[model samples]
Target: MGKFAKWLGAGVGFTLGGPIGAILGYTLGSFVDGFSIQDFTQEQEEYKQQTQQRTRVHATSGDFEISLLILASVVIKADGKVDRRELDYVRMHFVKMYGKDRANHAFKLFSGIIKRQISTRQVCMQIRQHMTHSSRLQLIHFLFGIAKADGNVSSSEEQEIHKIASYFYINDYDYTSIKAMFYNESDSAYKILEITKNVTDDEVKKAYRKMAKKYHPDRVQSVGEEHLVGAKEKFQKIQSAYEKIKDERGMS
Candidate 1:
């Protein structure tokens, strides 16, 4: 948890209150061994001071990681049983994204999290209040990735992820667009661009440009460079979708 400690102050900002705070405090305080109960989240006081100085700021990398753990727990158990593949997907992604040691700390906390009861809506409310739109979209993408890890996304898992997307205030078009990335629906390309297959070639081109900018990795740069890789994946999906649409319509 040394790296977790290093990011303690940086990651604890707006997430230190309400559900996110209570849940994290409990996980670290009661379950995680390295932390102290007296002041489990030592950065609580620091978080308050920083909040007073700013408003609705972007979530730091540490904050994003914590949020990911909470939502991941909710999604993993949504189907009534935890699939090893889904768990492995999350763990491997974290290891790939943050390396071995930090991912280990995350899994330790994640283990405790999955063992608890989470008020999904309330937890999401706290996240929506503090996290940026782009970051929230990334969360949706990650949750879908998790849901599909076991080969197919179950109905229950898709419903839970859809609820999270709604709680995050993601519009239906955007949610479908992200959802389309992992599925092979007939109009997947159109959905990825937030457009309909019936649209004219010109409208398709316009939607492509709009979505390209919207999903650009730079939109969530404040979340930190570790996330750019994931963001780039989402961005590339948009690019691929456009290419598919262009080929279908025989556009130049």
Candidate 2:
């Protein structure tokens, strides 16, 4: 069978019945012709959940895949123009996380997703509803990876990412911490640990432990084995930052 045959027709279809699915159907059918962002979502329960502020957990790998694709679309358009390097980064990362065939299907859907005007808040809230906080944090990290794929993350791109983080309910510390990973700077280590330069050595150690557990791959293990690879990369970054801080502070 071809990749398109498996599009939204594979990987357990966790989001195949939700607004994510509806959006996918709409994207395939509409492809931006008289597209009403509200057309498929107005009466959906997801919109209701967004208003009622309820938590609906049990997100599958498929749902995570859909959410990642949509948010990546948002970030890619953040700078008002698409960069081929950024586009390739999305393709390569997806292929790395998922196998080649699955990644190809997702990339095809992503090609369509990029053409439409998606409601960033609505899609994010849908993900926030279904996914655990840990999974959502992983989403934020993946998005930062997308924005930084093309050398530097522009100011507009940064702003769009910050907006998406807010929609996901990720606080500034977590956001800046992930941001620190891509763009290394003087205080990137401290930022990665979510600590301040003026903090005491003990506080730095405490922050390191906290961040280590928070970013541990096991925390996001529920997403899937593929995602754990990304999670481990994040965990290693936290470790590397802690080591750097320890080296500079002479803390044994």
Candidate 3:
């Protein structure tokens, strides 16, 4: 039988908090020998419990994926229209990460749920529920990348991503850190500060100083001294942001 014939013709459905992706991924990967019925049942039970736990938390990886789809769709549609080029970028990213078959499956699943126009906050909360601090930070970083992929970050996109990040449980320090990492310039210096565009110069300096201290590797030893490496990088960014802003405004 050809590959398409093996797809069970189920039309790829989406449900809240389910193990279907794991099941499908496992099944497709095991096509040569077939999945053991017993193993499938056991895996389903495990996946169900894991899914439930994640849903109860803030955001599962699944929720993150769905939220990404939502944000992409929203961003593309923000200018009173959706560009095929932008949509293509999203689809291509999915294909690269999840493979063509699973990517298509996920896109179909997303399309069904997106029509409901679910709350973006709810999606971020779902991610925060199950993700570690580091994971949440990474999600924020990814969101910025997606925002920039199409060239500009509009007010709508910025507002949407800000709302979504709020639910992800990322604190101001971490959120700013992630934003600065992606959006800051290499030479402009303010790229590292992580201050908002609306903030006053004094506030920017204060925030940068505070964040630099908090992320100081020596101060966060409980999470592991090794993590200080990350903190150091973050602090450097903060320093850069502060310097850039001061230079631009000619502040003392």
What's the distance in Å from true for residue 29, model 3? Answer: 26
lDDT by residue for model 2 over 12-54, one digit each (tens)?
Answer: 3345446566767677555445434464354344545544553
Give the alpha carbon lDDT tens digit for every residue of 56-95 in model 1: 6557888899899999999999999999999999999899
Top model by TM-score, which number?
1
Flag clash pairs in model 2.
Answer: none
Residues 137-247, candidate 3, lDDT per residue (tens digit)? 544555565666677666776676676667776666566566656553553344345455677877877877776765555643333343344456555666766766777
The regions of model 2 sitting more than 4 angstroms off are 1-3, 12-14, 17-19, 30-57
The candidate with the higher TM-score, 2 or 3, is: 2
TM-score of each: 0.92, 0.86, 0.51
Task: Return whichever of 1 and 3 wins on lDDT.
Answer: 1
State the C-alpha lDDT per candidate: 0.86, 0.81, 0.54
TM-score of 3: 0.51
